[model samples]
Target chain A: MTPTKTAPQNDLPEVYIDDILMTLKYFTDEHEVHLKIIDPQVCMNCESKPCVQFCPVGAYRTQDGGTVQIAFQSCVECGTCRVLCPNSNISWKLPRGGYGVAYKFG
Target chain B: MSTKEKLTFDVIVVGAGLAGSAAAAIAARNGLSVAMIERGQTPGSKNYFGGALYTHSLLEIYPDLWDRKPPLERPVTESGFWFLSKDGMVRATVQGGKMQNDPIDAYVALRAKFDAWWAEQAKKEGVFIIPKTVVVDFIREDEKVVGVITDRPDGEIYAPVVIICEGVNNLLTQKLGLAKHDLKAHASALAVKQLISMPAETINARFGLPSNEHGLAASVMGDVSMGLPGLGFLYTGVDSVSVGVGVTLEALTKAGIKPYELLQRYLNHPMIAPMIAGGRLMEYGAHIIPEGGWTTMPKLYTDGALVAGDAASMVNALHWEGTNMAIMAGKAAGETAVEAHQKRDFSAKSLSAYRARLDKTFVMTDLHQYRNLSHFLKSRPDFMNTYPAFLNDALGMFFSGFGKPKKQLYKDILRSLTDRRPLVKAAGDMIAFGRTIMGF
Candidate 1:
């Protein structure tokens, strides 16, 4: 019952980050920002700003004046930002029960 | 029930994922009251995996798992790696006839569906599942874990033994000083996946499979990660496919690429696009994999507490195995708990049996064998960048040598090897690869 080999020619598909996020279901906790920027000044001084690039959902975005904005609504809770932020500026905690991304087919 | 009895149990298993469920079920079946805590709305709502479940470990918990007809997607029959170089791929696969028979090797599964089903089975075994609750910290008494403090009101539940099956973000493990520190970017991998919806017939056709029941689990290395230390994977589900890439967090950070973008490049690759062409995106998710291996594993046991699964860094990264290790370790921890209760001693010395039990199984054996691997791979960037492309180029030359002399073709392949790397460096690569595999 193994998969057989086959070669086929097809056009490559285009992917949009926002379009991908649209397909997911999230029970947003309006009151709680489970993900927080512990020190905005620390983030501003941090040059690499790795969280802006490494976050899977792009929840952390840089504003015009150099501060980072967090759209915690879209967070998938991978916890990468908490660990990868060079300054350890992000305070991350689990969302309240039933209040985060609920994968339908994970 | 008395208030004391209502708030107490023999064991409290945290996280309700594969490991926690397995631990609760085994302990409850052994006549110990078990409470399993889950932070998700349901057991698997907050969980994600690489989409394959090995049957050997599950069989340890449910001997007749296949007969039970679990919510498994498809039995994986063909499994292999697709060595990719930007525009081309060289596939290597293994499909044994016996692997397709009874007691199948592995099955592709969606964690949401499969883990929910697994938790239900645990409940049936008399395990109390507390859903929609997060265990924030351990309730300790005299430096021994006596209970857990959750987010819910009056949520302190006392248990002599606590098993932490919490996944890769092991805050509790760190708090207990089990793990040396918070996970470093280099020590963990962030994987993002998209579940693509397609008809079963379309899936079968695209994959060149004989029937809907069989599936393929193919992992792509080399250019899939843009020559980075990561991999792309495609696992066939019943009516869909799971396509994803897992790259070390440090690699992703250093390269300045979003994980989803890396996944996008993999999806658009020439060798992969065709298989998933007409499918619609269903859901997207991300999870961190503990890649610290044996070197950074948290202390497995403490007085009245034990750690299992990703919390203990039990993943065998080389084989792409975590769930199986989690399940087996959980079962072993459950057995150890049973022994501890009988002895009426919950000291760390008594619970050291948990590690002894794992030592007898593949969980500890394989981890011990590959203890040096993560460090080896992390330092050797050329293994992913130079070797794969060189192999592909040499294969292309050999396959396209229709009118060329055989001697010239052999020389051409040798020239290609020296063109990318010095012969000495190539030999060094071989030795390093051998050491990685052979543990020399």
Candidate 2:
């Protein structure tokens, strides 16, 4: 439950998403080559960028040329970008068994 | 393994999450030649959860689960719920082992380790586990799904029946038009979580836990999501803690905050920061949960196919359980498929028994009871927002002990709350909340 409160002091937790992802790289069972780019025509000029708005990992983003870009490696397989895309444009599939994250402490 | 063999079985279970594993294991044990197709290299590699597992139903399937000595993190013997205000907090906690014969209701285990063990168990029971194979779509013949088409070369595998347990995002269900093609974001909650590294001694000192006892299962609200109906949870492992936040998808999108950023906000909250003061982050990930309860459920069964777990939307959101429901649902579906296999009938009529089985279990009963929960929160977002703030303020005022008159203190507290939301609205909200949760 997100609650409103006084501002925080910006004390950094010793954790970093980059470092966590790096550690996950060691446990990866296989190299990922499964994810496919969605039809660019549908994503081009897309302003709301629903995929960007809902992805928890910030994997999807609007790029310089009005094209949508996604970093599959950063995905923890949350599937939000796949499920909540307004146009249903994200053609998501399961990363090959053992190819994606082999979570050490899931 | 390549698809060079005749790839046919009595039943094919897709996606090796908890639900798929349960379905495959149960079906194979019941004398059905089951093929458990996993998109992961093994079970649990593609799965994630909130670090809690109710073992009652899982135990029902593998009565000797402990005999194998699976990689259980710790037997969860204590839990708490924290309602936080800016400076103060109110908490209610339960001691697990206190229930004399409850037999350890749940445990904390890492999914990657637990799932791999579970899939291995299924493989031992004669279930053909095809790891690293992705089931891209179903092969239907005359309106009956007879096989699955994977992404591999000649990846079509035929089966009389198929159990779809593809987690929350059931793309196969969507392709079959079982669920909506344009499902809304609000239908699920977006959960982002991290695993933090903390020494066992530090955990014991911090949570006041005995060396032998397991760690706490604590939940937090307020000041974690900027007044959004998001929740932060903390569950400890032997050497780590799993901390997470789950906000309604609609709320997160409307707030325009990245999930990681919100998670950082939770980590920085004055009340929350101290709990994990010296811990280092180890793992981070996110998932969409079926918190919409029964209301957002898709069709459970069709010709030659049945959906279990998140694919069937079987999560009891209020109770914070999906794995238990998945286990029970998969068990029921497995039993139903066994019946169908005996009769050689792969029709929806035969599979309706799966629904009947769920109806008799908490999976469906509790789901139906709280079918209106998502609606309630969507209508009145303040129960998680305004009420918490007011409650915190009231507690702070009443406990200040500044030598004010008791009667005046009580009056001031009432007046403060009523002034913010009015007595009439408060009364109405109470009634509404009662009706929504109590199922009036």
Candidate 3:
């Protein structure tokens, strides 16, 4: 028998809302969260920019002039951009407690 | 306090993920004073999965949970298996009665909320959950594990039994000498998933669900991985979709394939594109699942401690079921701990009952039966590369009517199978696969 009809829908609120609220609270003092690395020039700044496409929440975006920018507020820290990136441009780690994407259904 | 204020509990459970929460819940329910420690800020903040909860084992633990409001999104009504080629899909579907039942055959959930709900349940059952607390090391009294040392200030907890439900990265298990430190990449699978947001109505309509019902599709990318051993899946939830790909880390390293690229290819596939179109990607995460099954399971019990969940490597990948096994193992471990506490014996000999209980249960049975399947799949490149292409080719020819008769289509299919491995090998593989993994 097909198992499609039996899936259940949760009535709770979206978990990401909490994540967003937490992010807001975490970055209340700062506009942007920056990463410290040995060399900013290490980023090859690939024309295609795979991180922009791989980011689930569009935290990484490419400007018209082809510069990559990260909006830390939306970053869920799923680590996809770091693992998928061909170059070691993104230094990823877990977000502070009560911050980042709070999945309601995870 | 000299930075060493010691605390005590009847049981100490590490990692507040699904399995740990279940273990803590069961232990507390059995009237044992329990301490559940989590490294994350919350129970599920660090957890990731292509989430599907098989309710069988959960119902065994909480029989009346479904009678009230379940922390479930949608009841899965349909399931599909797709063998995908470069541009086409060869499909097989199973639907109806047996899959829909009282305890809910399966439910898709977001772990962050689901896990928190589960942890809250455990707390209600009298589990003292210490969140944001990292268990740094196993406190050894002689050769036996007597307690754990947390990173928190004044955080040494003494317990007769410590249940390690620490997921795939079992550092403490290795440190405590319960499991081997050197886990081969072949034994681990790297899975990456994304939660895509969509309107609930849109999701239900797109997946053809009636009201709150849901659908799931598990796809095998034949030759899509360039001969890597892995698969992809997409599960429909209430307001979103969970889609991901998992490949053996060794195979991925060898092939130089990126998991996200595999995910993109999966999403772009003709068969998958329509279903997930217009959905905004909401969350993305990755995890290493111990796919070694029974062979990789550690020494489950040691002096003064027991192991459960992924720390014990209890995942059953054949059915894409791990959470259920983890929950069941946790429950069993909790029951065993309770028994030991009553008898006041936490020696390795007494705690060995956890292993016995697991052996008699479906967790070990399923794991042992499918123990060889991962190896078989890893060894057989054709299962990942050739069969999918052949199936898609045969199906394409069978369905196309380009001024050709049915007999001609049959001849075309026979021709497609000629240069490939002999039909005998395919038949043998199928039989072996059914016997070992499917237990048929």
Q: Which candidate ranks first by lDDT, i.e. highest?
A: 1
Q: What's the CA error at residue B302 for candidate 3, in Å?
A: 0.4
Model 2 per-residue lDDT at A37:
59
On residues B1-440, what C-alpha lDDT tens digit does candidate 1 reach at each position?
23554498999999889899999999999999999999998999988988799899899999988687899988999899888887888888878777677778889999998899999999999999999898999888899999899988788999999999989889999988888898867778898998999999999888888898789999877877776777788999999899999988888887777777778878888888888898899999999998877877999999989999988888877788989999999999999889999999999999999999999998888888888777777877777767778878889999999998999999999998898889998898789878877766
DockQ sort, best first: 2, 1, 3
Q: What is the C-alpha lDDT of each candidate?
A: 0.86, 0.77, 0.72
Residue B252 in candidate 1 has what lDDT? 82
The number of the candidate with the highest DockQ is: 2
- Ordered by TM-score, highest first, the candidates read 1, 2, 3
Which regions of candidate 2 deviate over 4 angstroms?
Answer: A1-20, A26-44, A48-53, A86-89, B1-5, B96-101
Q: Rate residue B398 of model 1 by lDDT.
A: 91
DockQ of each: 0.38, 0.41, 0.10
- TM score of chain A per candidate: 0.83, 0.68, 0.56
Residue-wise lDDT of candidate 3 within B1-440, one digit each (tens)? Answer: 46555688999999888788888889899899999988666787777787688878778667877664557777767776778876787877666776666555888877877887788888989999998767878888888888998866666889989999987767677777888753446777777776788898888788777776656545556634545787777777778888888887667655544455566666776777898899887766667778887878888989988888877888777678789989989988999999999899999999999899988988889998888867877977788868888888887887775788878778779878766878788788787777767644
Per-residue accuracy of model 2 over B45-154 as CA lDDT, tens digit each = 77788868887977977988878877877677887677766565677688844622355777777898888888888788889988788888899999999989987778
Span of ten consecutive residues with least summed lDDT in model 3 chain B: B252-261
How much is the lDDT of residue A62 in candidate 1? 84
Per-residue error (Å), model 1, residue B429? 1.2
Clashes of 1: 0
